[model samples]
Target chain A: MTDAIELPIAANSDVVLVRQRVRTSAQQVGLSLVDQTKVVTAASELARNTLVYAGGGRVRIEVVGNGARGGLRLTFADEGPGIPDLELALTDGWTTGGGLGLGLSGSRRLVDEFDLDSEPGKGTRVTVVKWAR
Target chain B: MERVPILKLGDVLIVSIQIDLQDQGVLALQEDLADAVVESGARGVIIDISAVEIVDSFIGRMLATIASISRVLDAETIVVGMRPAVAITLVELGLSLGGVRTALNLEKGVALLEDRDNARAVAVPR
Candidate 1:
């Protein structure tokens, strides 16, 4: 099963719309509320990052089923300032904007697999996956 | 979109979050918190995020903004009982809440609010 949804909106005011869409789609694939919530959360966080920092980004969501278990994957790509330091950005308690340094680190924990790629002055891309295990 | 009540802690008010405070939920709350804090002028505000599982950058910014806005209004802000997973996500994403205060429980948050009111009452002697 190969299905994906792509959403591109202004980073300024599109967080809720994106999260709700992801949640609805995840459920349509027969994902439980728990799994759907996790996916919704990840999508929301990534969307927020895209809007707030990157001035907006794109969300790519795909669901794949394998035998007894299925999984959800989300990729958030932003062409903003990009992260200057990946390590520092990933570090808990370390934040440049000084909010609850828990977005990415926290999102990583919610899902099963997480990957991040960013180059300064280029862009940032975050991919997260959660398996129905 | 429920209207929150005047959450009372002793003599002070503990204004629970009106917005969902999750990823996108933060947007609605973000635009409202500062003004709400000022208008309500509650001695303390407790952002109950137990129902929320995630907080993104925009949400983080809103939380920060609430706390900052409260300072001028002679009020304090406390983020209460965020899920452990959410906390970790924020830390990893580089959304550090250096200025905002957090509590393990809503009771603790209320107590803090009460204490702040007492402190102010003592200073102003009203």
Candidate 2:
């Protein structure tokens, strides 16, 4: 990774900052307009999840490379009450927050790689990557 | 909390979102639009999001909610000027904006509203 930045996700405004920072990193990594939009949108969803579900958290935006290919990676971590069921949480239309429940599932579809980890009493961490095409 | 401004044009209320709207701003806009639709007695509401770069689940939901709210107030809602990339990202994000109508740009959106009004006028004979 050449450049990595961390931003807080404590409030609604912070989520907007996360999205802007991710979009900049995605563009710097040579992502196309559509690819930039995809990664940024995914980042927005995860950042909001950190705030709404976990109370507050932080996100690390990184520019990664694999030989000649470059990608943008985002890691959102929060210490709030962790999810009990990973499968159920990732399922579409299943939400406890009265939302559409598409944040996790839809974000997964927008990126090339997605990994989520959470411990009931511990915390939750979600990492996603989108490569430039 | 920065609020998105709503402009009035003829019998339509136009809201051009040019900022990276926070969640609070989105909610405020929804309320503002509902009020504007009623206060102005607008027959149509046009939301221009051409300047908006991304539309996450929250923003997508805001659009749908605004559409529903305007419908309840007896005004048609049409979202216009959505960037191609934004459209693609929204679909991939699993938000089709189901109840919200869309147009290529503001001009087309206005024309659509006008056509609907004309059709309604003929049908009602008033």
Candidate 3:
């Protein structure tokens, strides 16, 4: 694991910034154009979720290496009204917030690994990683 | 907030997105395009996204919404120049862009609009 860069997700512009930073880090980890696009797209979804669902949050982006290969990892955490049902939240086309509801489920398909943790009154944290192939 | 420019060409309105758009910019473009379609009385609207690197659900939905809005306004919307990688990502992202029409490039997009116009003219006399 290398040094991580953390950015605040307070508004819509922050989501764009997170995407840009994730794309840069993905490239630095030697991910291909397609992989970079995938991760960056995933970052955009999660970043927006943090801002819109959680009101505000922060993200930590880092480059990771496993043996000989490299990967990019992102952790998005928000302290707002957390999800009560993880399964429902991950369901396709399920949304309480007027969005298309693909933010969580769709992003999960884009990356290599995904983990979501949330409590109704606590917070939500989503961690995703995409390894270079 | 930066706004995407809309150019007029005869009966078509063209918008080429060259910047990494924020969500607000995306919404603004939608409103602007709808207004332009009504005000200019354009028959077709073409969006060029060759310069855009990624298309998340928000942008994907924006395209669909624009198409729906233009259809109601009696204008056709064609999205052109989607990168292959973005295409792959979009499919995996579960956004089929069902109601949106797409072409490989701007020229083909214009040709498609013209073809549709010709077809309509043939189908209806006037």
Tell me the tens digit of each residue's lDDT in model 1 across A73-97.
8889988899988888877656665
Candidates 1 and 2, the one with greater DockQ: 2
The CA root-mean-square deviation of candidate 1, after full C-alpha superposition on the true structure, stands at 5.2
Q: iRMS value of model 2?
A: 0.6
lDDT of 1 by residue, B1-126 (tens): 444454554434465554554444445555465666666556677877776655666667777887887767877889898877667666645667879999987889878777876787899974
Where does the lowest 10-residue lDDT sum fall in candidate 1 chain A?
A93-102
What Cα-based lDDT does every candidate model obtain? 0.72, 0.92, 0.96
Give the candidate number with the greatest TM-score: 3
Worst ten-residue run, lDDT, model 1 chain B? B18-27
Residue clash pairs of candidate 3: none
Give the TM-score, chain B only, in order for the candidates.
0.75, 0.97, 0.98
Off by over 4 Å in 1: A29-35, A80-85, A93-101, A119-122, B1-41, B46-53, B57-126
Which is the better candidate, 1 or 3, if ranked by lDDT? 3
Clashing residue pairs, backbone N/CA/C < 3 A, model 2: none
Q: What TM-score quantifies how close candidate 1 is to the native fold?
A: 0.64
**Cα RMSD for candidates in order:** 5.2, 0.9, 0.7
Candidates 2 and 3, the one with greater DockQ: 3
Which candidate number maximizes DockQ? 3
Number of backbone collisions per candidate: 24, 0, 0
